[model samples]
Target: MADPIKDTRRMIAEMQPRLHPGKYVFCSGIRDDLAADVANVAKGSFVEDEGMSFIIPQEETDRLGIAGGVAMRQITLMVRSALDGVGLTAAVSSALATHGIPANIVAAARHDHVFVPADRAEEALAILLARQAEAQVGS
Candidate 1:
């Protein structure tokens, strides 16, 4: 019998330390109402204040916000190797898809993070944790 959770964890173990678990919320960078409401908001590499309108884990937020709805999830990502190509992303995406978990992956030079709907964060964590476990066992 194939244990999906075990397999997923195996994949995660082989990657770099990428997941930083926390409540990631969207906030305004420049204190602009339009930017706050829009789907596109600036991601702060460093949070000036934890009380900011939308404060996630200081590490999870990026320096620049792209054109996508940010979904907060508890499961952290383990990015394998420098994100020089899209292979890792495609693999992660496919894995998530198979689990019926929808995800939007953003890959940076140093690491990669996944944004899933806030409502689905727990479920997403279970999936990611499984992946992490799988990676550990394999290694």
Candidate 2:
């Protein structure tokens, strides 16, 4: 495995945002049998207390009867960011906020994933790319 990046600036500059294929929905109450069902159909991030707020494909959501409405698309930041890294999420979210994009971020062991409105996925990606470009030029 490669070393995780700790520099906030480098992380942002090199985070090649890649759009995940498929429309996804946010689901909750994925415990017990429901949890098992979700596991079989889709993979997603789980947060305790907040319940499982992970992205499940729309088709899987519909077939599994998971209650989700707002359609979203996943944009994975292809930067191996350290979990302890600072300012990465802040910078990304700030840029998106400036563009009036709502971002639901999930930081995994290796990468950060942002879920944005399905219709604005392209726009969100452009915003992220621009942020990265600015970081590169500023460095």
Candidate 3:
């Protein structure tokens, strides 16, 4: 694997944001046999006092009998960013927010995943690409 990027500009310049297909939703209170099949495939999940919160595919909601509200799309940052990388998230989120797009960032070991509303996904991806280009030019 490549060394994780730390420079804010470099990280943004190379974070090739790829918008994934399909819609997803955030739900909670799922902790039963019905959830077994979808558990491993969840884009993100966490355990809270109320229940198990999950960012799952919208299609899975039907079989799980959960309300899949607010369809979203996942955009994976292709740049390998260090866990402590500064400014990358802020820069990306700010760019999207400026255009009235809400972003939920999930930072993992390899890269950062962004979830944005499905309807606005194309616009969000375009914004991120523009940000990347701007960073590249600045570099």
Candidate 4:
């Protein structure tokens, strides 16, 4: 099997994700302190099978006084890694951070999802593309 981290460059395309930044929200049935507290809903249900759970930015969450909450943003790249390694996350995060882009990483069994701010979507794509190119050239 190909290494998840090493093979990611070939598995996914570098995309310039377009974002329509507006009011939005999502809910996870499984609530935990680690998850963002955007809003509290007494009704409705969430699907836990979906690898990561997060509520997008919504007016209700604002009204509920959620803090440390991140606004809905764009994800320039979607990558999958069968190998769940902490080292890969840190390395990828460090690469993005070096370019002054904040990456919110969520790891699922089959892949790792990275969410970047809508405003920085273009720059984020450039960074990832460059990284992919570098990997290609090096190999």
lDDT per residue for candidate 2 within 1-139, as digits (tens), equals 8899999899999999999888988777765767877876665766767566666788987787778779999999999999998988999999999989999998888899998999999999999999999999989
How many clashes (backbone N, Cα, C below 3 Å) per candidate? 11, 0, 0, 3
Give per-residue CA lDDT, model 4, range 1-139, as digits (tens). 4445444444433222233345333444434563444324421223567644455555655555544245545442344454543355565577789988888765655555566765676677567666766656655
Please write out the lDDT profile of model 1 over residues 6-112, one tens digit for every residue: 23343356544344555465444433544443334333333356534433442334443422235565334554444344355566667678878777665554456
Better of 2 and 4 by lDDT: 2
Predicted candidate 2, C-alpha RMSD: 1.8
- The CA lDDT at 67 in model 4 is 45
RMSD of each: 10.2, 1.8, 1.4, 7.3
Q: How far in Å is the alpha carbon of 134 misplaced in model 3?
A: 0.5
Give the clash count for model 1: 11
Candidate 4 — what's its lDDT?
Answer: 0.52
lDDT preference between candidates 2 and 3, better one: 3
Best by lDDT: 3
List the lowest-lDDT window of 10 residues for candidate 4.
37-46
Q: What is the TM-score of each candidate against the true structure?
A: 0.50, 0.89, 0.93, 0.53
Q: After superposition, how far is residue 51 of candidate 4 from its true place, in Å?
A: 18
| Ordered list by lDDT, greatest first | 3, 2, 4, 1
lDDT scores of the candidates, listed in order: 0.52, 0.87, 0.91, 0.52
Candidate 2 has a TM-score of 0.89
Give per-residue lDDT, candidate 1, residue 4: 23
